[model samples]
Target: MQLTEAHAETGMTLLEGPVFDEDGKLLVVDVTAPEGEPKVMRVDVRRKTSQTVHTDGRGAYTSAQFSPYDGRLYLTDFAHGEIVSLPPDGGDLRTFFSGEVGGAPMNPDDLAFDEDGNLYVSDSRGLTEGEDIGRVVRIDRAGKEATVLADGLAATNGISFDADHRGLWISELTRNRISHLLLGAEGKTASRHTAVQVDGGLARTDSIAVDADGNLYQGLHGRPAMAVYDKYGERLATVEVPARQAEGLESATNVAITPGGTRAYMTVSGPAGGYVYTFDALAEGIRQSNGG
Candidate 1:
């Protein structure tokens, strides 16, 4: 098959972050309101069924990931800038990390983990019209206080470490760019640089993923397409989604690439009501990497 829509009736109102569990199931967060109560949903691809992972009736869980250390799901309560750890099978929920140290806005958005199990969260305080603030925070596994590793950016929305965990790629939504922060040892300090800035009408970049070949796949919310870039910061290809009348091909929010880099998934959330999209390697070879 050439990329067909699956699980259209899952009731995913505003599906953003979709991550795979070790057991081959996909989980996504569904929020009906912008900052309203949200639920974590687990979808079994093989069985074609959906189950509620957890629902708190509090702030919406916009983004999440599975912690390799304890196998628990860590969810981000965007409005409160809190991270909560939930049981793998959906039971007890406890606060993982919350608070603003030194008077910084820790509006956590998306998260990723390093080899040592340290968590990296992208905080988007500049998203609002008057906020004019943003930062990327790192919280080690010891439950200690959080600290801003990078500061004064234009809305840091998504973040992930390179395969070697030596480099970080963060998406700045307002600036339409992805920044590369180089790090060394103890996860202590780093130098920052812009990897790529995609500034077209199509650049509503959100969650991103890096492929096995060190290619970055960025999702564009304004346009139903995904931009692929090489390690040296070159625009390689743009994967187009099948057009739809109401929702378009991709409301193209949070993106996740397969471990092999051969497949990718994006949440299409317009009038389609949030359906997961899969694209294969065939759609990826259409462009050559720009000379870097």
Candidate 2:
């Protein structure tokens, strides 16, 4: 497939999360510099322009998702170890979950909400390698409590619900694999098994997004391609990104598809800056808002 440069060299320190809001605008997080403040950017795909929507002068933001239950935007604040929210129109950010919950530090990397409005967070522990301390926590809709669904993961990063809302897919970065957790009646994890093992140059998987047809799109950290997989852990295709376009980037951090799945967006991160690339997906993205 031919990939087009939707926006490039935008001076973003590091771009991670990418999600389409209800208005059809793509919302992404600018991680800024290492230990630098983070900002949320709204991208106009047609115009190929990006504008800052929310900026936190203190912490780094990683992922952003729009919740259909409350019609608000929820974000993962990595630096501050918190989950925050704000109106879709943009306003003062409010803390949804903070400090430590479920006997673990907050260090959330990415998050996804379940069908019942419960938020699931991947607590990465900020460790890059050889650490089995990562965890997956579930936060109630009221944002008052948390429950650890799974632990002892190697850098839990990406997370999303399957198209049927019966399985929760999570990416274990250091382990180089994705796991599918079966959900019980009350949104609790009943069991989990490795869904896919990423190998070769694209071993390190970061974030994941699903299409309406139950195909999974994974952002490869060490490669320039997005790995595609079927619902039953079968590799279907790999979308190769042009090297010249991702010039200085070291990894593709996140992938997001539009509501209609006609177009897809990806974020590549590097020291110089981050780049957001768009391509024709022509597939309907799974409705994450409805926990699909």
Candidate 3:
């Protein structure tokens, strides 16, 4: 695959959480700024330019997702342990949910919504600080209440629903594998099993995205490649990212495919610097509106 520069290095301390807006513009979170602040940015692919859409002086922002039900952008503030929302038209931001839910601290890392507008959040529980208590919670469409779907996860990070909408996939960063949870009739996790494990060249797995054909794309932290697997968890292909493309391409933190599935955007963060890269996709990505 030919890797192209979507946006050049911007001196971001860490870049993660990439998703395409309705207009096909790419949105990403700058976890920490060079001056030690958190912000969200929007990138125009055709123009090869980016603009800061939102900034939070409180804490680091890790992820952003456009909610199909409310027509707003939801974000996870990892440092403050809260979930906030930004207006679609680039208006003021507001707090959506915060504080402890289910008697556990809510340190949301990544979020995914189901077809019915219910939000699934991965509460990392400050894993970066050597905490192992992680939980996956489900927030209703109204954002009034949250229910814990799964708890005691090593490090709940990337999350996505399958193309078929029959299962939910979550990356266990500390375990170095992906877990597939079968959805029950009531839309809860009925059972879960290991879907993919990093055994050979790869180390920890971060964020994940699914294509229309149920293929999974995973970002490998220790390797300069995105691990691809079929629906059955069988290894399919590995897309090697060129290290020369950026200073720290080896640490692929997140992956986001365009609505057309023709292109993919990724976030790389390491000691060298942080960057966002784009490349041609082998398959069509599942649209976020379809609960991807």
Better of 1 and 2 by lDDT: 2
Model 3: runs farther than 4 Å from truth?
1-12, 34-38, 126-132, 200-202, 288-292
- What TM-score does model 1 achieve against the real structure? 0.86
TM-score of each: 0.86, 0.89, 0.88
Name the candidate, 2 or 3, with the larger lDDT value. 2
Top TM-score: which candidate number?
2
Look at candidate 1 and tell me the lDDT of residue 29: 79
- Model 1, 1-292: lDDT tens digits are 1112223343335677777766756777764533223377777755667777777657567687777677778888888878888886787899998888448546788888776667888888879863547788888876595777888888888787765568788888888889988886767556899889886485577877766566777777776677878878888888766654334444566665444335556666655456666776422310110000
Predicted candidate 3 versus true structure: per-residue lDDT over 1-292, tens digit per residue = 1112223333335677888877888777777653323377777877878777776457567778888788788888877778888885565788888888988678788888887778888887747766667888888878898888887787888788888888888887777788888888766889988888865355677777888888888777676567888878888887766747645555777788777666787777665556666777667767531222
Tell me the whole-model lDDT of each prediction, alpha carbons only.
0.68, 0.75, 0.74
Number of the top-ranking candidate, with lDDT as the measure? 2
Candidate 2 at residue 182, lDDT? 94
lDDT of 2 at 243: 59
| Global Cα lDDT for candidate 3 | 0.74
What shift in Å separates residue 279 of candidate 2 from its native position after superposition? 2.1
- In model 3, the clashing pairs are 261-285
